[model samples]
Target: MKKNLKRIAIVAMVALVIAACKKNQESAETAPQETVKNADKVLQYIKDLGFPASSIVDNGNEFVVEEDILFPKDMQIPAGGAGTKIEQYYTGSIVSATKKLNIRIFVDPSMTSMSSEINSAIAQWNGVPNSTLRFSIVTTAPYDILIKNEALAAPPGFVTCGQAQFPSGGSAGALVRINKTAIASNSFAQRARTICHEFGHCISFRHTNWAAQGESTATNVPGVTGTDALSLMNGGQCNSGATVLSQKDKDATAALY
Candidate 1:
């Protein structure tokens, strides 16, 4: 009888342990209310931006894109595209002539700490002496509105999410919209890298298309060289797998500024 009782006790303890573990797991999986609400906002933004509807997949706390340029479930992207590089047609004259301009970052409610990060990014640009480009933050409406206004005077499709200036030396603007949930999910370095990458786009950079390691991807056309891993404009992983800016990016931006 004692043997039977001991066996029963062991089974009961095992069951209790399993139950406790499951409860702990459940708690761990549950995100804070703010995080969940923010994630929903990001999804709605993505939908408004016109990403492929089929790509949206809910993965618990955030939405994830499983194929063809994976995006986090919590990010709202108007257009999903990798970065690219373009030849600067207008040279020294235009670069020297373009005036210091203002750039406004329209923040979606989902972006938590964008203001501080943006200020720091602009300061980085300011460090370049004699560079005509200058930027300031404007929090108002759609960033695209500003892009459209600037685009009107720009080269034909010149101001893209890829590049900064038009061929004519006209100043363009970049608009950044970030997802806070996605930011927290990633390391700080990775998040910063992504911010810098987007900043590069505002300045008119293309994805690094340079070929190395036997990796050859088609650029827009035969003549155009796409950005590569070493190039800050490239869409590949950066910041030690976190997406930080490349040295090339600093050089390129410094050249402009």
Candidate 2:
């Protein structure tokens, strides 16, 4: 009788362990499915914003569209994602006025060599006449954005100088990755332009020449409509783009902020 009781007790213990293991396995499987579902949503949101499927590159964790704009897999999608209009275009979503007043940037150690360029870029935005948008570099924790050096991959016939995420949840986009080596040969002003351009993305600025780049459309800043030849926000020009914001760029900055 004693032996039978011991055997039964051991069997029950094994059953409980098996049940717990099964539960864990189920949870593990469910987690990836959820991740995939969220990624799909982000991909759809990118499509809704008028980025053609051909221009979108799935980089495992994010979508690199138009070569420079990055849509992270886990980013907060704006409610009812949709595209609007053109001319000095915006992403429809933007950094809130209050949050735009002082967007803090933290430079990672890898990007310390470009500190001057980063400051130069910040100065361009800060100098926007009558606009309250500002960016100050912070060395410690709790920052609104992070700028770091990354060896960005280059596609055939194109060199990616930098990449930036877009604004979400009422704040600036949180990440800016600069291909330090790729743009090392560029002049200081052009280097700053690269940084400045990526920062533009952080604050919700789209490529000013979105149409030319095959983007479906983008919402224009009020009263700032019309293509801008000197706009620093134009894509594809890379190291050859404008070194400073054009008059229309300032107008658009003021219009939004």
Off by over 4 Å in 1: 1-85, 88-100, 141-174, 209-231, 238-247
Model 1 CA lDDT for position 139 = 64
Q: Candidate 1 residues 1-257, lDDT tens each? A: 99999999999999998898787775754555446666766666544434345656664644432111223333332232222322411111122233445444554444435555555556655554545566655567533212111111113533222112211123332334343443445665455555555555555444454234222232332233334355545544433432434455555555555
- lDDT for each of the candidates? 0.43, 0.89
Clashes of 1: 23
Best by lDDT: 2
7-65: candidate 2 lDDT, tens digit per residue: 99999999998897788884667766677888898899888887788889999988898
lDDT of model 1, residue 124: 59
Model 2: ten consecutive residues of lowest lDDT: 79-88
Best by TM-score: 2
Name the regions of candidate 2 deviating beyond 4 angstroms: 1-31, 83-87
lDDT of 2 at 84: 54
* Residue range with the least summed lDDT across 10 consecutive positions in model 1: 145-154
